[model samples]
Target: MLAQTNLPQVAHGAPYLSVVVPIYNEEESIPHLYTRLQEALDELAKPYEVLAIDDGSRDQSFHLLRELAQQDGRWRVVRFRRNFGQTAGFAAGFARARGEWVVTIDADLQNDPRDIRMLLAKAEEGFDVVSGWRAKRQDPFLNRRLPSQLANGLISWATGVRLHDYGCSLKVYRAAVVKQIELYGELHRFIPAIASWQGVEVAELPVNHEARKYGTSKYGIGRTTRVVLDLITVRFLLSYSTRPMQVFGAVGLLFSGLGGALLAYLAYIRLFMGSPLADRPLLLLAVLLVVLGVQLLGMGLLGELVTRVYYEGRQRPIYVVREELNIE
Candidate 1:
C-alpha cells in the first residue's frame, strides 16, 4: 500500500465522499484547482476527504499539495517515490480511502470539479458506477481526440460495456465496487468495464471539459499500444479469468482434431492407394499442427492448476456478496 504523505486521520469513521486527484506536473494549476475544488466540496455540506496523489512530479506540484494539506484537514497527500503512472496513483488512493463513495478527478483542471454533483445525482438513482461523458472534448483532433475515439470504441466493443468517453477523469463509484478491483498497468480508465463482471449497473452523464491552461498533456500515441493490450486483458478477465481451460482447450482441440483427420487420411492413402508421402508437404503441416495443439493444451492445464492452487492457498471467496437475507 502507498503511504500517506503528511496528514493524520481526521475522523474516527469513514467520510461520505473521497475525491481522488492524481497529479503529475500541474504546478501552475494547483492554486485555482484547490480553491474551486474546496468551494464545490464545501457547498455539499457533507463530511468528505480529498486524496491528492502526486505521482512523483518533478515540478512544484508536491510542494503545493503539502501546503494545502497543512491548511485543511480534509486534504490528504500521497506522494510516490517515483513515477508509476496514473493507474498506480489511483490504486494508492483507493487503498487509503475511507468513504462510502469515491470519485476520481484529474489535477490538470480539464475535469470540472463542479460536475461532482452531477455524478452523485446519477449515482443516487442506484448506479454502481457513473461515468462522465465528454461529448464536447476540447483537445487537438489529430493527436489526442482521434486516438481517444478509436480506443473508446474498441474497448466498448471488446468489453461489452459501452461509454462515450472512457478518457474522462470524472467518474463515481461505490466504495465496495472499487475496492474489489485489482489495479495494474493503465487500467484506471477501464473501471466500469472491469466492475461489470460482478453485475454492476453503470450510467453515464455529460460533463464539462476545459482546454489545458497551464501544463502540457501527459498522454501521447505511445500509450495507445498499452491501452490496446490492456483491452485484451480486460476481455480475458471478463470471459475466462475464472475458468482458463475453456478458451485454450477449445482451440487446442480444434487444431488437434484437424491434424489427426489429415494424418488418418494420408495413412489410408499410403496403405490402400500405394501413394508415396515422402516428399508430400501435408505430412509436415499435420505434424506441426499436432505439436502446436499439444503445447496449447499443456498451457491450459498449467493455468488451471495455478488458479486452483492460488484460490485454495489464500482461502478466498470466489463470489462477492452485496447483501444477505434474514436466513443467514
Candidate 2:
C-alpha cells in the first residue's frame, strides 16, 4: 500500500542500464554518491538512467534528489511518503525500471561505484544475476563484520546458494529476471537465493568495499534475528511454495505419531498395572501433544487453501507502482 505521486511516463525505448539506489537519510553523502554514480554510468557510453528512490528521509535528501533530477534528465527520483524499508524501495525502482539490465547499490558510499563495470561485464557473460561479494569488508569487526559473516554462511547453507557476502548491496540483474521476483519485507537479502529458485543463472564476484564516511549504520544486532526468520521464509518458499502441505503434513505426522505412541504406552500402563491416570502428569502431556498435533494438521490444511487462494485468487502483484519516471 505505498502511495506514489508525480509519476511520469517512460520513454519509448528502454535504456541499456538502469541503476536503482535506495536513499535513506543520506543527505551528507548525496553529492559524492551522485557524482561517482554518474561518472560510472557515463563511462559506459550507453543510454542509462538512475532511479533514486528516497525512503522517507528525515533530512534534505529528497530536496537534493529533486535538484539533481532537474539538472539532468537521466536522474529520476521517487520519494516515499514514509519509510518503507529497503525492500520496498527496490521494488519501487524495479517496477519503473526501463532498462535491459538493472543494478542496485547502497547509498552509504560504502560500495564503490567503480566496481559496477565489473558487475556489468559479468552479467554480459549470460548471467541472469550477478551478486557482489565484499571479500574485504571495511566495517567494524564485531558489530557488522562478524554478524554478516555468520548470516551469509547460514543463508548459503540453507538456500544452497553459496555466496560469501549476502549483505553486500551491489548487484546486477537482467531487467526481466528482476521484474519477475516480488520483493517484500527483508526478502531483498536473499535475492540471489530467490532468483535461483527460478533456475536463473547466478554468479558472484569479488567487489571493492569502502569505509562509510557519512551517516551512522542503519542496521544493528536485531537485524540478524530478522534475517534468520526471513531465511526460514526463503527456505519454505523455495521447497514447498507450490505444495506447502508436503512440509506441514510431514511435520504434523511426526508429532502425531509421537503423541499416539506416548498415549498408547500410558494406556497400557493404566490397563495392565491399574495405575490411576488422573495422578500422572504424563497423561496430561500426552493429551496436550495429541491436541497440538491435530492443530498442526489443521493448520497444514489451511495453508494449502491459502496457497491456492494466493495463486488462483485476484492477480494482485507483489508491488504497487505509485509513480514512475523515464520509464515506458
Candidate 3:
C-alpha cells in the first residue's frame, strides 16, 4: 500500500523518488512494466511514483498505461500529442516529476528495474547522481552492443566522466540536480557530463543488464552521429561556450598588438633609414596582425553584446524556491 502526502500548493511537492520512464513503441513491454516497477520499489523504504511519459507511440502502449495508472495511484502516465524523441519524453517527465530523487530508465526492459536499488543506495551515500554500468551487457555485440560500447568510450574520453557505460539507459539523480540542468536535443544521454559541468558529484555502479524480451531497440547508428555533435556542443557550453568573443577576441588582441608593434618598428625604419615599407615581410605580418586584432576585438564586443541581449530578453528570475528532502 502507498500513500501520497500533499504539501503547500506550489510547482512541485516533494516525494522520496520519481521514476521517469520514457516510453515509445513498446506495446509488448507495457504488460510487464508495472510488475517490474513494483518489484524494484518494494525494496526501497521510501514513497515513490512512476512518471511514465509516453512519446506518442502508435501502439497500445499509452492506452494500456492509462488503464494501469487508473488501477494504481503510484503509477501515472503522461501522453504526448505527437512523437517527440526520447529526450523530449524524458524532459517532459522530469519537468512533471515531484519527487526528491529521479530515476530514469528505458521502457524496453534492457535495463533491469531491480538495479534501481543499487543506484539509490549509491545516491544515499551522498553523490548527486549515480549511473548504472552494464559491465556484462547481455545484448549481442555485432549490432547494437559494440556501437554503444564505442560511443560510450569516446564520450567518456571527451567529457572525462569515465564510466564503463555512459550510454547505459538506467541512471538515478538527486531531484535538485535534475531540476537544475536544462535538457534538450539528444543531451539526455550526456546527463553526467552536464551535471559534472554544474559541479554535481557523479558516480557509476555495475548493474545487471538483461536482454530485451519485448519490443525493438529505438536507437541506431543515427544516434551515434547525434551524440558526437552534441558532445562538442556540451563541452563548449561548459561556460561562455556559445559566446565566441572570449576565445576569438583574446587571439585577435594578441595578434593585433604584435602587428601594431611591428608596424611601429617599420615606421621607425622608414623615417630614419628610408627603407621601403612594402619590401619588408615584417611589415606585411604587422598589417595582417592589425587586421586580425580588429577582428578579434570586434568579436569580443559582439559576444558581450549577444550575452547581454540574451539575459535581458530572458528576464530570468533571481530567486528560486528549493525544498530539502532525505537529508539530515
Candidate 4:
C-alpha cells in the first residue's frame, strides 16, 4: 500500500517549530503560500522548517516544492507515490517532525499562515493541543457553512471536545502529544478529540479565515456522511476500545430481555387464555428479536477478539516510512 519517505538531510539544524502543510493540486497557490509562510515564520525569529507534503498532486505541486527545498534548506518536501488522503500526509509529516512544536495548515491559502502565531500563542499557555476556531467562516451559506456547522456540532457533542471548528486545518500541537495519537482514514479532523484521550490539555482560539482564491474546495457535502462514520469510529475508540464487550453486550442484553419478555407473554396468552399463536405477528417479532440479539452477542465476542489482536498482534505502526528530508 502507501509508504512514507523523506529526502536527504538539508542540515537546517533542529527546528523550534515544524510547519506541516499538505498540498494537493494547488499549483497556483504554491508561490503565494510559500512566500507568506516564510515571511510569517521568519518573523517568529526561531529556528523553523516548513515540511510541505505533496499528496500525489497531478499538477506542478511537487516540482514547485522541490525547487523551493533546493533554494532554502529550511523548506523540506515529501512526495507520496499516490494520493493517500490528508490523514496519511499528516502522519508522514508527524513522523519526520523534529521540532518542539508542530503546526498544521492547509495549502489553499484560505488559512492565513500568519494565524500560526495565534495558535502558538495559545499553545504556550501549557495546552498540549491548540485548535483554531473560525468564528466567522467565509463560505457559502448553504453548501459550505451550513454543513460544516452541523458537522462541527455533532462532532463536539459526540467527542466532548466542544470546539466550534473541527474542520479548520490551522492547529498547533506539541510534538510529543501528537506523536502519541495515531492517524488513519479521515481522523485528522478529530485530532483534538484523539489527543484528549491522553488527558492532555486542549484549547481553541479564533483565527483568521479567508475564502478560497485558488482551485475549488476538495471536500463537499458528500464528506459529511464520511465524517459521521469516522465520528462513530472515534467514539468507539474513545469509550469502548479497552472493553468492547461492555457496549455490545449491554445493547445485546437489552434486546434479548425484550425478546424474552415478549415470548413469555405470548406463552401465557396461549396456555392460560387459549389464544392462537401461529397467526400472530407478535410471535414473529419476538423470534426475530431473539435471533438478532444472539447475533449481536456473537458479534460482540468477535469484536473482543479483534481488539486483542489489534493491540497485541504483530505490533505494526500505522504509517510506513519511505525516507526523510532535512531531518537528522
Candidate 5:
C-alpha cells in the first residue's frame, strides 16, 4: 500500500478528484495549463485539487507553480530537488493524493484538461482504471507515433493488458486501484498491467491530443529502450515476484536432465559398446552442461531465499533520495 501524507483539503471538504500533473521544464506552459485545468474542473462543479509535481525543473516552472498554488487553495505543489524523471514525479504525486479518483497528465499542455470529464465518466461505469488512447495523435509518425505503436503492441503481447497508447500520460485510476500498487523505475507506463495482478477492470478511451505549444518533447527513442527494459522487470514482477524459484528451477531441471542423458549415453558406450573415453569434445560439453545446471539450481535456491526476505522481511525499499528542497 502507498503511504499517504496529510495534505490540505479544499474548502468544500475533501476533493473527489485529484489531478496529478508532472512538471519538467514546462515554464511557458504552466500558467495556461493551470488556467485550463481550473476552468474545466470548476465547470464539472466538483471539489477537486490539482497536484502539480515539480520534477526538478531548471526553469521558472517551480516558481510559477508555487505562485499559482498560493493563489488557489485547490492547487498544491510538490517540488523535488533534482529531475528524477516523470515516473518518480508521478510516484510522488500518488503518495500524497487524497481523492477518490486520481488522474495523471503531462504538463506540456498537449493533454487536454477537458478530457478529464470523459475519463471520469468512463470510470463511473465500474472500471478501476481508464486509460486515454491517442487515436488521432498529433506527432511525427516516424519519430513518435510509429515507435509508440510498436511498444504498445509489445507491451500488450507481453503483459496481456491491451491498450493502444501506453505512452499517453493522460490516464485515470480509482484511488483504491492506484494506491495498492507501488510504482518504481519506469514502470509507470505499465500501471494497467501491474494492477491487473489483482483483477482490476481497465478501460481505454480516445482522448483529444494537441501538438506541444511549449518546450521540446522530453521523450524520444532513448526512452523507448528504457521502457522495453522495464517491461522485462514488469513481466517478472507480475509472474514470479512471489515465487521466482518456479521459473529458475524449471530451467535448471531441463539443463540438468539434458546433461545427465548425454553423460549416461557416454557411460554406456564406454562400458558396454567399447567406445573411446578420451579426447572427445562430447565429454567436455557434457561436463560443462552438468556444472552449469548445478549453478542454475543453486541460483534458483538463492532466488527463493531472496524472495522470502523481500516479502516477509521487507528490508529494502525501491527509492531513497535527499533534497535541499522538499515541499507540498
Candidate 6:
C-alpha cells in the first residue's frame, strides 16, 4: 500500500469547498494560478482551500508550491515520491480535501479558475458531477482539439454520457463523489463517465478557455491514443466488470465446445463412412480448434487467478510522513 498524504482532519471551521490542482512541470504558471484562484475564491463567498498536489515534479514547482502554501493558510501542498500522473495527483489531492464540494482543474491556465462559480452553480442544481466543457478551445487545430473531439465522441457513444468535452480538466464533483471514485492511470479523463456508471447525476456547462501564457501543452498525440484505450476500459468496467470470470469463462467454454464438436464429428465420420483420420485436412482443422480452445481456457483461468491474488492485495496504501499539516 502506498502512503497517502493526510491533510489536517476537519475539526472546526471546515471549508465549504476545495479546489484540487495537479501540477507537473508547471513552474511557470504557479504565480499567476495562485492569483487567479484567490480571486475566484474571494468571489465564492464561502470559505475554500486550494489543495495542490505536486506529482514529484522535477522542476521548481514544489518550491513555488511551498512558498504559496506558507504565504496563505488556505493553500496546502502534497508531494508524491515520483511522477504518478494526473490520476495519482488527483487521488492525493482528493484524499486530503475537506470541503463539501471539490473542484478539479489543470495546472495549465487553459482551464480558467474564474469559471469555478459556474460549476458550483450547476452543482447547486443537484448534479453530482458538473464537468466543464470548453466550447471554443484555444489549442492548435490538429494536435489537441481535433483529437479531443474524436475521443470525446467515441467515449460519449460508449459510456452514454452526452458531453461535448469529456477531456476537460475543469470539473466540480461533490466531495463525497470525489472520495468514492478510485482513480488510476489516465482515468482522470473519464471521471464523468465513471461517476455516471456509479449512479451519480452528471452534467456539463460550457466554460471559458484561454490560450497558454506560460509553458507548452502537456498533452500530445500519445495521450490521444491512451484516451481511446481508456474508453474501452471504461466500457468494459461498466457492463461486465464485476464478474470477470463470466466474460472470460464463457468465451473459453464456447471455443472449447466448438473444438470438441468438430473432433466428435470427425470421429463419427471415420467410424461410419470409413474416412481415414490420418493425414486429412479435417483432422488438421480439428487439431487447430483444440489448440485454440486450450489457449482460451488457460487465459480464462489466468484472468481469474490474477484478479483474485493481485488486485485484492492492492486495496490499502499508506505512505510514510515527512511532515503533517492541519490535522491534529
Q: Which portions of model 1 miss their true places by more than 4 Å?
A: 1-12, 309-328
Compose the digit string of candidate 5's lDDT tens values, residues 173-212.
9998887777778989999999999899999999999998
Indicate the worst ten consecutive residues by lDDT in candidate 5.
Answer: 1-10
- Give the Cα lDDT of each candidate: 0.85, 0.85, 0.78, 0.86, 0.84, 0.81
Per-residue CA lDDT of model 1 for 1-328, tens digit only, reads 1124444435445689999888888888888898888789878878888888888789998887777776667777877777778998888778778888999999888999999988998897899999999999999999889999999999999999999899898999999999988788889999999999889999999999999898888989899999999999889989988788888888888889888999999999999999999999999999988887888898889889987986668443222222111100
Q: Least accurate stretch of 10 residues (summed lDDT) in model 1? A: 319-328
Per residue, candidate 2 scores C-alpha lDDT tens digits across 1-328 of 1123343334335689999999999988898898898788779878888899988889998878877766667778887877889999999888888899999999998999999999999999999999999999998899889999999999999999999998899999999888888788799989889888779999999999998999888888888888999999999999998887788788878788888998999999889989888888888888887887788888889999999998788655344444544333
Those runs of model 4 whose alpha carbons end farther than 4 Å from true positions after fitting are: 1-9, 314-328
lDDT of 3 by residue, 172-261 (tens): 988878777767778888888888866888888998888888987787776778888898877766655557687778798899889989
Clashing residue pairs for model 6: 1-317, 2-317, 2-318, 3-318, 3-319, 8-326, 8-327
Task: Report the poorest 10 consecutive residues by lDDT, candidate 6.
Answer: 1-10
lDDT of 5 at 252: 80
Clashes of each: 0, 2, 0, 8, 0, 7
Residue 306 CA displacement from its true place in model 4, Å: 1.2
List model 6 lDDT by residue over 22-101, tens digit each: 88898899888988887887898898888888877788988888766556667878877777788887887788899999
CA error at residue 233 for candidate 3, angstroms = 0.9
How much lDDT does candidate 3 score? 0.78
lDDT of 3 at 99: 87
TM-score leader: 5
Window of ten residues with lowest summed lDDT in model 2: 1-10
